[model samples]
Target: MRQDTEVRTFRDGPSPATRRRVLAGGALAAGLGGVGAAASEARTAEVGGVRHGTVRADGVDVFYREAGRPDAPVFLLLHGFANSSFYFRHLMPRLADRFRLIAPDLPSFGFTVVPDDRGYVYDFASLSRTVGAFVDALGLRRYLLYTFDYGAPVGWDLALAHPERIAGIVSQNGNAYLEGLGEAAWAPLRAYWAKPNAAAVESIRARMTLDGVKAPYFHGVPDPSVIEPESYTLDAAILARPGNADRQVTLKLDYKRNLERYPLIQAYFRERRPKLLAVWGRNDLFFIPPGAEAFRRDIPDARVRFLDTGHFALETNGDDIAREIRDFF
Candidate 1:
């Protein structure tokens, strides 16, 4: 389904003119009525062709955003840290006509709810299991996996477990190589991994603030003004939930496990030889450009494309990335 590549607003209440004016004035924070208001509005109903729903999976309520026809080839979009399926709000609609897009909020992020009694472990392996349960509950037998940030480890885990289920992979700033680790930006995480002391944990927790949430979105973008403020604002609001900070800290510590699994993931790449596409943000400080280039070492035919954006490439280059996926697939 082709969509007009004009400035479009996702909310139902705002007129196009009013939305444009509000965006121009840089008052979206006020117009969005803070985090509570923005998240509440998003939860109320579907916007554009995207529909929101929840399914019980592995004792956790897995919330997801879905679009496109039920029978279309599946595109399982797994988001990164501090983000939910909401991150795909723009890109899903753009590709809904061609692919069945399903972006699920992992157990800890977004709208997914974990009961206090469930005692869910906030680690990559557990998260991958929950996502596997989610996929089974949805009856998705085969799909094209889209991995970013934290999603890389989870998606790779799935691929390693059930190699027959994945049709292909699209890695957007999803690093699987040690060389891809950006030492400067990852100092705090590395420090936490080295020592899970109070100071180390506090350093990682400090990034849960509003400014820290905004950092990845603004870091390498040539024009920060084009970024929608609601993106980070909503993430900050979600991170502020009670007990959420500790959950994130736990995940940060467990990230070392993902690093350890890099060799195994590379083996999967060589043996399975799944169709792969790496669309990277050249300026991403967390996952460098070499991460994208490394995919070619295992699968010589893998396609890699770099966009002049920051960590969140879809935020700035959604249309271009969408076009690339359509052409490559």
Candidate 2:
């Protein structure tokens, strides 16, 4: 086995020159809009009509992307670290036709506003509670949960808190297994958690740049030209907001709490046996295939698929993932 620190470092990312090239190039063929004008118009005409809103939930102004018809089955999309509801921009448009897609930018991430009073904790437990308040604020009785990366813990906690409210679960590179957090990939964060000194903080912050944000989308893809550079560029700008970096590192250090609850999360899966569909990226270096396969251990009927992509599978296989979700529901 590779030593804990032997995993590759993300410190070295694409330079500014490369990002400038991508933005100026034809790689953004799709742009932020969908395929063609007709398709884009049709997508916008979907039920919820891709509305953006902010609601006061648990003392924070939680920003969310609401699309599809309210009467349709609810599909709650929870994003991961270094990103916000914007992560689901591509998938939301596609699924909005059938399901009620709601993607929120958690506090301290996107446009969501968290007060400086320090009244709330930044750990997963508190974040999970905030998510619960957001769900209840929207009166979501039962909804499909789409969890990715950081979303896994929050969604799982929500399921545990209110089992009757869950319609099903869709996991994309979400981790519920210990083995999913490969040591090499987590070394820096682990170091931070252990020491939490200035040096440790600097180690993790080094990759919080624009290039680091862009790396995940095209990490293992064969064709890097397909993904739009604007995706990460926008996210990087959000992370650069005042005090957001410290909040992110605090969350990263608190991730150990999520791992501690993994057993309870698995117990819920085995006992409650919620319908599960894991659309994973096989090339994901963090949450590896074993984490996706672990779903089968509890829910025998779980549908698991390993895609030919990286952590952000939707960047390359959004259409495929969307189709699978539609069929699964």
> What does candidate 2's lDDT look like per residue over 47-93, in tens digits?
63466666566776677776664445678899997788888888987
Which has the greatest TM-score?
Answer: 1
Clashes of each: 0, 2
Poorest lDDT segment (10 consecutive residues) of candidate 2 = 1-10
Taking the tens digit of each residue's C-alpha lDDT, what string does model 1 give over 300-325? 99999999999999999999899989
lDDT, model 1, position 182: 89
CA RMSD of each candidate after superposition: 11.8, 12.8
Consecutive 10-residue window with the lowest summed lDDT within model 1? 26-35
lDDT scores in order: 0.80, 0.76
